[model samples]
Target: MKILIVGGGMGGTILGNNLARRLAPEMRAGKVQLKMLSASDKHMYQPGLLYLALGRMTPDELYRDQVSLLEPGIDFEVDPVVSFELDHNQVKTKSGKTHGYDILVIATGSRPVPEMIPGLAENAETFYTEETALKMFKRLQAFQGGRVVIAVGVPHKCPMAPLEITFMLHDYFKDRGIRDKVELHYTYPVGRVHSLENVAKWAAPEFDRLGITYETLFNMKEVDGANKVVKTEEGSEAKYDLLITIPAHKGMEVIESNKLGAGGFIPTDKTKLTMEGRTNVYVIGDTTNIPISKAGSTVHYQVETLGENLAAIVKLGSPVREHDGKVFCFIECGKDRATYATFNYTVPPDPKPPTRAVHWFKMAYNKLYWTSARGLL
Candidate 1:
């Protein structure tokens, strides 16, 4: 059996390692083969991008060699898959080579497309990537003190990011002795400040405590960079000296070019983790239209179920279990305080108040992520 895993993001790398270990006997016997194809040779701990933008972490701490995280016996390559010939049970890579597989795992992650919103890319500061995060950090440093309006878009990664950044920025400015000078404002597209109801309930009070004003149901329609104003779909405009936005997201371009799903997300079975109508082809992480927060923890739980099912299929000729939509996310609430939300499909997250201990744990997890990527945590 040949297992081809595409995209070396958290889901692919961890699942690859998990699958490789579970099928070690078969691999040693030459009965099975595992290969991974990724666009980059370095794997980034994406959560760090938030801290990077806040200047809490350096750029060098955000990456590690991709191959170092993968388990042996897995043939890992940097050639990116440009074509997903799912109907033909094969994929074509950037190097013009084709590879066939008995089972395919598509974990190609999503990308933030701030440019999708008119004038957003040119006007607002976003921290979804290394370049953007560093740039946002610089912008934050130079801001003298005025309206720092934050707007959010749909289907973006990390449910708590907007809230997290807001809270962190409150502390950031306080540390700089300018918390009173800067007025922090947040805007969310939904009726509440956060998509998760409990989180919204929790964060609203936090916002009030921090003196952060917010406008809910405020969606980004266009940014008038020339006027330093952002017009919303709701016909409201917010003027800002500095604009920060959590832009919308879409899956990899290959997913779009291959006509996999609308906006590049692959239509995936939420429980089975398989592509719709295709049992042998699986989808995980940000690539799947799973309607969950696209955090590393979501992918981690998805991988837990997927690795088991894949190994079961190889050994027992049948799969076992289903993904329960389990996700665990730590909410960093600045001031050396943090809290977490852990839930599954059937449960809702009821996050407690932030604590310094949890904050330290989150900080420790930043370094321990590589170990977790190796499936050891």
Candidate 2:
């Protein structure tokens, strides 16, 4: 049997690596073949992009060759997939190659589309991509003191990133002795600082302690770059000297073009992690339209059942598992301190207060992520 996987991001890499390891015996016996397709040759540690924006990590340290992360048995293709012929169980890529598979996994996560809002693409600064992160770093370096706004867009990959960057900015300006001169503001589209109500309750005190202005229900409508103003859908507006935004995110154009998405997100079975109608097709991570944070930990948790279910399908003709929707994240609180929280479908997140230990743990996890890519952790 042939297994085809699209995308080489965190979810894709982790799933492919884990699956290859689990099916090693089948691979050796020529009973299964695993192939991974990616649009880019470079694999970026996405969370590190925040540190990269803060000048805490270098570009070289944040990226690796995509081929280097996979085991020897898995086939890696560096080609952009243009279309999916799901009816035929095949995928067509820009390289004019067609790959057929008995089972297909669509871990092709979401991508940032700043153009969704008028003038956002050309005017606002972002840290969602390597290019944007590097650009933001330069902007941060030159920023002396003024109104700084950090806007959190919806359906973003890292829900904690806006808060993390905001806290880091507190430290960044404070270290330079311009903390008082720089007025920091954090704007969220949701009713609170975070989607998770409990997490938001925990973060409120921290934001207050840091003297950072927190604005809720501020959905962005358009950016008046020429005026350095961000206007919300409710007609509220804020001016900024430097605007750091997590622009709206959407599924890849391919998924939408292939008619597999509802407003750019794939509709899947939350319990079984399978495509709505397609048999032998599965999706995880940011690609799914689940009402949970699109985070790496979410993928890690889903993989627990996803891996088992896929294996069961091959051996038992059906899956016997379900996704728990477990997700957790460490929120940076500046001054070398951080906090953590865990949540799932049925439970509310209980956030741990800021501590130096959690901060260090996050730092260590960045290194360990490499191990995870190799299916070792």
Candidate 3:
């Protein structure tokens, strides 16, 4: 039995470690082999990117060598996946290598699509990636703002990140004595500040208290970069001296090229975590069309359920476990305070108010995340 895992992000690396440990007996007997294929040697601690813009973290701290993060006995290859022969259970890489697998796990994850909106790629700035986050930090520092807008296209990873950045920006500007000089604005496609109604309700008062302006149902249509303005499909316009936009997100190109599902996302069984119409293939993380926020917390919970299910299938010929779609998010409120929320697919989060202790907990969790990825925590 051979397991091929595609991707080495938070979900892929953790799943590889879990699978390596669970299938150790088979591996020792030469009955099972585990290999991971990643596009790059870098595995980023993405959650820390939020703090990177706030000067609390650096780029070096957010990334580790991907091969070093894998568990012992797991083979790792650094190559770009060109296509997947799903019917044949084989994957082709850019280096013209083909690999066959008894079981395949697609954890390729999501990426920003700035090209989805007109003028967005040329005009807007973002902090979703380490490169972009650090660039935005410099832009924020040098901004002599008239209007600063934080806008999202749609369906981005880390549901709370834009809000956290908005809060941090308020603090960032105030500390620099430019709070009143800059008007902070946030725009989202959804009708609420957050996807969850209850979380949005909680955030309403916080937005008011912070003096941040928020616009709902503002589906960005185009960016007039030359004029320094943003126009939405709903016939609204905002002039921004500096624009920070969370570009539209999409699943991996390999998935799309193979026609796995609409928009490159696999339509997966929410509970079973298996690809529709395929028992030997599993899908997890942002690659799945699951109605959950594409956050590391979601992946963290999915990993345990996936590991249990995969273990059962490999050893017993069937899966007895089901995922609960549980996730938690820690929202930074700046001023060294943060709020925490926990929920599942069936429940909406009723977050606690901001607290300084939770802020420290979030900071501590960043260090724990590194060890956790290495399967030490």
Choose the strongest candidate by TM-score.
1
Candidate 3 per-residue lDDT over residues 1-377, each given as its tens digit = 88899999988899999988888888888888998999989999988887887687988889889878888889999987898887999999999999999999999999889889999888888888888888888888888768999888777888888788888889989999989999999888888998878879888788898889999989889999989999999999988998988778999888898889887789999998889998888898999999888899898789889887787778998887789899989998885899988999787789888999999998899889987787555
Q: Against the hidden true structure, what lDDT does model 3 obtain?
A: 0.87
Could you give candidate 1's per-residue lDDT for residues 1-377 as a string of tens digits? 99999989999999999999999999999999999999999999999999999888999999999989989999999999999888899999999999999999999999999988999999999899999999999999998799999999887988889989999999999999998999999999999988889999999998998899999999899999999999999999999999999889999999999999999998899999989999899999999988898899999999999999999999999888978999999999985999999999999999998899999999999999999999888
lDDT per model vs. reference:
0.94, 0.87, 0.87
| TM-score of model number 1 | 0.99
TM-score, structure 2 vs. true: 0.97
lDDT of 3 at 191: 89
Candidate 3 matches the true fold with a TM-score of 0.97
Against the true structure, what is each candidate's TM-score? 0.99, 0.97, 0.97
In candidate 2 the C-alpha lDDT for residue 260 amounts to 94
